[model samples]
Target: MDLLRVRAARPAATGAVLAAAALLAGPAAVAQGDSTTQSDSTSPGTTQAGSGWNDDAYRGEVEVIPGDDETADMVSGVVFEDADRSSTHDDGEKGVAGVQVSNGRDVVTTDSEGRYELPLEDGMDVFVTQPRGYQVPVDEDNVAQFAYTHMPQGSPELEYGGLEPTGPAPEALNFPLEKDMGAKHPHQSCVIGGDVQTYDEDEVEYARAGAFSDLAARKDYSSCGALFIGDVVGDDLALYDSVRELSGMLNGPARFLPGNHDLDFDAESREHSVDTFRAQLGPQYYSYDVGKLHVVALNSIEYPVGDGYNGALGERQLEWLRRDIAEVPEGRAIVLATHIPLLDFADQGSDVHQVDEVAEIYEILEGREVITVGGHTHSIENLRAGDSLTGWEETFGVEELPFTHLTAGAISGDWFSGEMLEEGYPTAIQRDGGVPGVITLEARGEHLTERFTARGDDGSTQMSLGLNTPAYRDWFAAHEDDAGEAPEFESPLEVPQEDLGEAWLTANFWMGGTGSTVEVSLDGGEPVEAERTQQMQGEGQRVGAEHSDPTAVQQQLVHGGSIADRSMHLWRLDLPEDLASGTHSAEVTATDVHGDEFTDTVEFEVID
Candidate 1:
């Protein structure tokens, strides 16, 4: 807390007094680019007592005192220079303007000269918005640079070094910039991940052991940082530090967007809704560029701050986004990342969760090649050419991936309560029957390919059953009381192994009644019953914690809640352990109570 005393202002003989004050501040006070000049004036109460002046001839001179604390309360430094000459913020240069600068609560902007002053709380994060045309400086090895350090005395120590230990705020937090070079598409790749809501320490371990572990082992993302699109934690803010540690496991930088669960539960107004998140992470909505891609991370959870909702980007953030995106070159691609899927497979009509102003957002990105990724709905959904999910407003009928709308499944699959695997992690199954993993977008000069890499397995072709049911109604209800019952099994009547090799039957049955059976037979032969094991599956039933019968309640509580009498049966049928590598036809059958039955035949290919 070094405080410099404000010097008394001397009476000016003319308009030159203010210019003198600028000189005393420092040599860096000279305007970098702007031409605005300062003017000198006197207070109304000041009277000239000199020889030539009468009592009422002159107003009192208002002394401008340089407060003993000349240091900015919030932002201590600015990285105004883009040292790499990339016109984008790199490792060591300054930050950009019109970016939302904050000290956790009071947000402000930088002046034309890229100079800003905002009040800061005791322990706050003062970050800049990496504007479109210019980039912040990068370090020696090319890590995106951070602004000045401003940690007040006695701020809590970062469990893992939170902010770099760089002393107090600098006198001038000035960032440098460079002119945007003319048209040329740069090779760019953006990393997109869906929901990573870790509920507890063990689940955090699951995340660490799963995809994150795989991410740690690779070096592919060293140049392009990782962007996690919401659901950083499962409603636990404490996991933020742990999450950061996970990011460190990567060879590149990692940024995050606030998911619904990442929100401050106790936040009252829009200003405060994401206070904790902002404090722990950075800004709620911000834009940055990597190569030719303009990445805009938005806060889509519009809940009430003081008077209205805070989910969608409010007028202020929306305006900022408009301006930010406007600065991006027409040829560049934009990636909008958020938590709740702007469009999703689950809950297509729920207004509270989906992006309300989807059309407006699309309009913002109409002409550009844009892609959106989200994670609230834990499923791996890829909308390729000519595909549109049900319930989307016609205006938002995304004909193509319209820049790929992918829903990254959760790391804690189905809440991490599944049966333990040989690897010691829960078999937390995914809703879409797809394995839990990360989606890597291989972007080589505008052309993009979507690849799904399962957590424990190498990146490979992933196919799972999308089971649903219009049959087997009674069987689902009969075993409703059993704690553990076999899933209604289905046997494949024919094998397409020769024609469609390496394909797995992903049974996405909807009414998998309690205790029902699903068996599959290759070659239209005898059906082998697939075991119905509870690995934390689908959003489990929700029930009251305190009940009259504790024993019965305890038995019913499988992972987080009691399995309802009839739950949807979503299962994946793997090829037989000893089946030869070739095409195989199989018949599947589901037997319900009251001697009723439903059957279907499908073919799949297998390869060694």
Candidate 2:
């Protein structure tokens, strides 16, 4: 009666299967919170996370109808409106007509009676796409329940326990739903947490202290919920329970994904590789609607050979994508969610990491408004429409992006590597010098905008402002061979008058892209435009110390982690060799394409 709360038996994840949790967090003991920083955040809200996290929200059990045979040709199901809040189809529950149901390939809408039948095959998922004004039920951990996986003989013995042998396909798979009063409103906040990728318990705690803290503290994404892009764990699928516990602390519903790290290494074939992940999490790929948007989760990783994975969708999945897009009306925007990017700034030249059939994907939704977000590279990237890469053209025959492609950097930044902050998480600076965080996609009807909240910090801290001197670059060249054990780049913010002309002020804007602007002002003087280092205009990647974020590299070289050798969002401006020498302050303002702006300040000294 309170919505279709499933009491029926559903898929159970085994202790040995790969289990997971979507992650977004804040600093439990934030070092950034203590910094002497002031700002006017580009953030839509004054604070990203509200104080209210509904720990006592409703929970429902998932259901999978019982059946006796594995040879059934078709499966039947009802999309009932649980008006009685009984969680079951009681005598009074009425069927909701016109709902869409799919068995992975073919999509069918329910008749006037709210029931539909589809051809069934082994290794397929039968799910209901929650229609506008209707809400799906969530489980104890706030993971939405709307699909049933059918794997009769289950998986071959995997390193992590694969799905247990589901003896037969069920005769009927009824999907329960409740009407959401708030669904009438077309605005929503959706969180995309990239790679959690926890390796062990300590890293799990690091995740808690970092991204999950940030996520749990936020009340904004309760309706659209949070979808973790992938890389749920680092090789150890055994850490699922620990991660799930962290997900339980989230303020809203949570969804997990599969990445290269979440594979079943011992599986016998390509399709079976992620059976353990699906068993622990939900479907491999599925779709759902929130407000005016239709979100498609894709399993883009193709493992043709043992343990060797590439970013490509199989024919079956691609065909499904075509069928999936056809169902949506032209008025709504489509958000494609995958673990590996359709194409990315981080791996623009690499064929394996970027989606192989990107041009085909672009062709599928030729005229529709499409936005893609993904994880895997572990860096923050905000590549926009018309952004082209020579490698994209050479490798995938894609000349330019048809729509925006946002890379949601990992919650477990740099594999959770680097010095621990006071919040109990590592600085974990990424290859792009962006810190660990989650990307929030705010949507009002079909229009979309996004922002990144770094672990242990607020919205105003979007960019890291600093000065890069010639001495630091020289030290970088000298210590290039020695990381973690290298001597600290001393007095990095101080400048010599002779080197002032060679010094540059840099802003590592985490979410800034081609349409974004970064301006600098000295001692509150008039602002001057700072040049973007690597313009996303069909150019090859510009790498090395000169292109790096000096602030992030200083921490990485002195501590331990991947070097932030290059970036797509970094902007720089050379300082003048002035006549006077004194302590000086520079203010930086970063304005995103949407015209939202954040201003931050950094202080430096010039000695004669």
Q: How many residue pairs clash in each candidate?
A: 87, 16
Which stretches of candidate 2 lie above 4 Å from their native place?
Answer: 1-56, 84-86, 304-307
- CA lDDT, every model vs. true structure: 0.49, 0.77
As a whole number from 0 to 100, the lDDT of residue 407 in candidate 1 is: 70
> What are the runs in model 1 whose C-alpha is more than 4 Å off?
1-171, 175-185, 305-311, 384-386, 394-403, 465-608
TM-score of each: 0.58, 0.91
Output the number of the lDDT-best candidate.
2
Q: Residue 138 of candidate 2: its Cα lDDT?
A: 74
Cα lDDT of model 2 by residue, 523-548, tens digit? 87889999999998888999988898
TM-score of 2: 0.91
